[model samples]
Target: MTLKIDCQLRDLDFTEVGTHAQKMEEMGFDAAWTFEAGQDAFTPLTLAAAATKNIHLGTNIAVAFGRSPFAMAQQAWDIQKLSRGRMHLGLGTQVRAHIERRFSMPFDHPARRISDYVRCMKAIFDNFQNGTKPDYKGEFYQFTLNNPLFSPGAIDHPDIPVYLAGVNPRMCRAAGEVADGFHAHPIHNMSYLKEVVLPAIDEGAKTRGKSVKDLHVQTMVLIAAGETQAEIDKAVEDVRMQISFYGSTPNYRGVLEHMGYGDLGKELSQMMRSGQMAEMPKKIPDAIVEQVAVIGKLSEVGPKVRERYEGVLDRVAYYYPIPKDAEIGNWKAFTDAVKHTA
Candidate 1:
């Protein structure tokens, strides 16, 4: 399958979101996504939906535990209507600490909770679209109350695609069983995807009488590509730091362990405990960086990514920082190359 290139809109200025999305559409991107970092994920997509006509809009992830299913379904339904049926609502079960301490929400049984969460959202969507009674009672959530006044009514495009973001086996399985697509973490190599992620998702898919091929597998790739060696080196260093940061999390230690870096994962966790965040990147070696990120010249990146993930992934986006205005042409070249490659 030919891999489609997706774009993540990171422009912080709300006023510039529509224009940025328009530029991505003109560049021939398949989707424009936003993450729940410092701002609301759904809000920007609403802007993008209004500003652009063809490009798909989605949340790279909105915290599923942070909002009720009703609230999330409401936003998704409105966007699907406004975008004329081009909204993919991606949800994530953020780390326990963030879900509990940061969002002041409960985080018990995250895997099951997220699975039930997706079902609940779908139930709500069904009720709105087909006038089906909202009577879904899952382990973590229940949706039995939906008055006609509370409903957003029916829309022409009510079949919104839902994607789940995960790294561990259980969550990957949950995505397979429940979601329309699975979002792979950037802190991963092909080995982990083949040995861990794909098998886990397949296992879950079997429970639902489906298979891995039934779901879309999208990943965020850390690409260290640049016009010059110096720029490439800087990008590689940035990717190394990102890998270290993500590998420190216990939930993601499996990826490191599978990559023969279990001890490094432990040390990174120790550094996090000791508040040595600034020194953690130095511990990641160049070899690890090369394995985790695609390193090459600007012209070589597209083909290298295709060679690495041609059949395994349906869509991919760069995990690096959004390119500056001057750097947009280079990114456009990468996207064009990805589309035209044999």
Candidate 2:
């Protein structure tokens, strides 16, 4: 079993990412993942690739709808070559609003679009490496690369792995059928993962005649560590606030409702729409917080995380939300404790 440690890019800057990637590599972590919500992940990833030599650098998820498949393949291939073959290109289809409204692009049939996008990317990489023209005609994308003048020329190809970010059943099955790995969201609980997500993956793999080992399962965990009770309370509140925001989204409401917190989802949704998001955490039920988060003492968090990985997850990515200047002693202590379990 390998233990991979990754922190969210939301809480870290470019300089911090390079420094932390080196530190995490020294700490025996297998990989470091960067995220993109509003900021571009490519710049920080390039810095991380330059700073670290061993640890794999990847995106927790780069939204596929924001960029074309050809451009994304070129960027991932360049990064893979630069990192000396230690790059994983993780992609996800975000909500329709981000695609249609924010980016001013078409958003239709996301499942099919993701499938076609992956095929197109892999075909482009293969064609570029073998010095052969790529002729692919999919429903969403069509490409014919036969011109030498526009080509980047024959280059050494690197093994670039693709992981899919999935939460629902159909997405999980799609990832299992085609993607190298499945990146699960942070709010999912162990029971839901074991009963819902893993079974779906297995079903899809069975249909495709692929072994379970061929599919990697990566999950995100929100973590905070502190000695005092008050500090721990603050950390828990921070996670609660994040969950509150996610619960309000229409796509994630079903997940919260499935966990027996449907009313809380409704309340949080109303609060978010009315511009009272900051106060919404105060109304979250304690049961829901305990079910979704790994809060409390270092000793307590280790076993809870281990429990989440018992039968389903292959890699666990911890999301650290503390400021750079803040004391990270407690955070380090928590990781040290969990290292034994891993």
Candidate 3:
């Protein structure tokens, strides 16, 4: 399969999204994604839809429990119409603490919850498009009422694609069972993808009489790329920090343990609890850094990433902290290199 390059809109300002998305489309990006961090993920896509015609718009992940499935379907439905069926709805069940403490929402049985969530959304969309009865009853979410007065009737594009984000096996399997695609976490290595993620997804796919080939697989890759040696070193340092941060999270411990970094993961979590953030990155060995990230100069990054993930991923985007401006102007060279190389 030909690997497609994807990009992210990191700027919180919604005003600049249209122009940035326009540039991404012009530069030949297959899609642009937004994540739920400090701002709403849907608004930017709405703007991007009006600005670009062919480029796909999606949420890298919008928190699933943060809103009702019906509400999310409505937003995605509108964007699908605005973009003429180019919207992809990506959803994730955030960790328990965040869902309970932060969002103040229930977060039990995440794997099952998300599975039902996707089903509910599909049923709601079916009702909107085909006037199919919105009778979906699942373990977590149940939606049987859809008054026509509240429904956003049929449109040219009603079959919106749903992608689910996950790291653990259960969640990965759930995604394969229902979602149109799976979004791999950025803090992943090829070993974890091959040994754990793919197998679990395939297992879940089997339950549905499907396989990995039936779904789109995509991920956010950690890349340490720069034009100069000093710049490359700086990027590596940044990547190290990211790896350390992810390693400290309990949810991501499986990837570390699978890579023979179980002890390192425990140490990082301890350091995090001790408020020793400055010391965590220094503890990540060069071996772990190389395994988790693609390190090279700007010119070499495109080919190296393509070579590393060509058969493993159907699509990928470079993962990093988005600068304040978050314009695609600086990334044109990198984007061009990937397309030309492909």
**Cα lDDT of all candidates, in order?**
0.87, 0.76, 0.87
Name the weakest run of 10 consecutive residues (lDDT summed) in model 1.
320-329
lDDT of 3 by residue, 1-342 (tens): 777888787765677777777877866778889999888989999999999999888999999999999999999999999999999999999899999999899999899889999999899999999999878898888889988899999999887889999999999899889998999998888989999998989999999999987889999888898779999999999999999998999999899888888888889999999999999999999988998899887668877777788888888987864444434654665666665543
Q: Residue 308 in model 2: shift from native, Å?
A: 2.9
Sort the predicted structures by TM-score, highest score first.
1, 3, 2
Clashes of each: 0, 0, 0
Off by over 4 Å in 3: 321-333, 339-342
Error of 2 at 147 (Å): 3.7
lDDT at residue 79 of model 2 (Cα atoms)? 85
Model 1 segments more than 4 A misplaced:
327-329
TM-score for predicted model 1 compared with the true structure: 0.97
Residue by residue across 148-185, what tens digits does model 2's lDDT show? Answer: 66555555545688988878888888787778888988
Taking all chains together, the TM-score of candidate 3 against the true structure is 0.95
lDDT of 1 by residue, 122-147 (tens): 99999998889879999989999888
**Candidate 2 collision pairs:** none
Q: What's the TM-score of every candidate structure?
A: 0.97, 0.91, 0.95
